[model samples]
Every structure is written in structure tokens, then in C-alpha cells.
Target: MLTAFLRVFAGEGHPVVLFLDDLQWSDAPTLELLRRLVTTES
Candidate 1:
């Protein structure tokens, strides 16, 4: 879900401000993917 949002945000050429409500509830892979998204280019 977050990856799709990131991809769409990147494709639209818009900056994103993600406010995760319950980050602790997120799975490890999802968190890891978000980390990669921040470090890597779209």
C-alpha cells in the first residue's frame, strides 16, 4: 500500500508527507520498503 502510494506520488512529480498513524503495527517488510524508498530514487 505504501509502495503504491510512493510510486504514484513519484509519478505525479509531487512531494509526499507520509504520516503513518501506527508505525509500530506495520510489518517488517513494509517498513524496510519505506526505508528503501527514502534512500533510493523513484
Candidate 2:
């Protein structure tokens, strides 16, 4: 679900701002993917 949303945001060429309300509650994989997304240069 998140991946699809991100894909659409990227497709639109708009900067995506994700507000993760609670990092502690997030799954490890989701955090990892978010890290990769921000660090990656497309």
C-alpha cells in the first residue's frame, strides 16, 4: 500500500513528505524501505 503511494508520488515528480507519527510503532521493513527511498538518488 505504501509502496504504491510512493510510486504514484514519484511518478508525479512531486517531492513526497511522509510524516511518520511514531517511529517506534513502525515495522522494521517499512523503516528500512523509507531509508532506502530517501537515500537513493533517482
Candidate 3:
């Protein structure tokens, strides 16, 4: 699900910055998802 979401902006010819608010309150799964998103960029 996260891969599909991030892939949407992978080739849009523009910069995309995701501001994740309240990150400290996020769950482990959510953090893991973000880690995968950042490390798997093409």
C-alpha cells in the first residue's frame, strides 16, 4: 500500500515533500512504511 502511494509521485517531474505531522505518535508499522518509502526511491 505504501509503495503504491509513493509511486504516484515518483515520476511527476516535480519535487514532493511529505510533512508527516506528529511523527512521534505514529505506530511502528507506519514508521517502517516511511522508511521503506525513503529507501526505495528510483
Question: Local distance difference test, per candidate?
Answer: 0.75, 0.73, 0.79
The model with the greater lDDT, 2 or 3, is: 3
How badly does each model clash, as a count of residue pairs?
0, 0, 0
lDDT of 3 by residue, 1-42 (tens): 868866777665865678889998999999898888888856
- Backbone clashes in candidate 1 total 0
Scored by lDDT, the top model is 3
| Pairs with backbone N, CA or C atoms under 3 Å apart (clashes), candidate 2 | none
Winner by lDDT between candidate 2 and candidate 1: 1
> For model 2, how does the per-residue alpha-carbon lDDT over 1-42 read when each residue is reduced to its tens digit?
556667666755577777777778889898898887777655
Cα error of candidate 1 at position 27, Å: 0.9
Please provide TM-scores, in order, for all candidate models, with all chains considered together: 0.51, 0.53, 0.66
- Candidate 2 overall Cα lDDT vs. reference? 0.73
What shift in Å separates residue 24 of candidate 3 from its native position after superposition?
0.6
- The full ranking of all candidates by TM-score, starting with the best, is 3, 2, 1
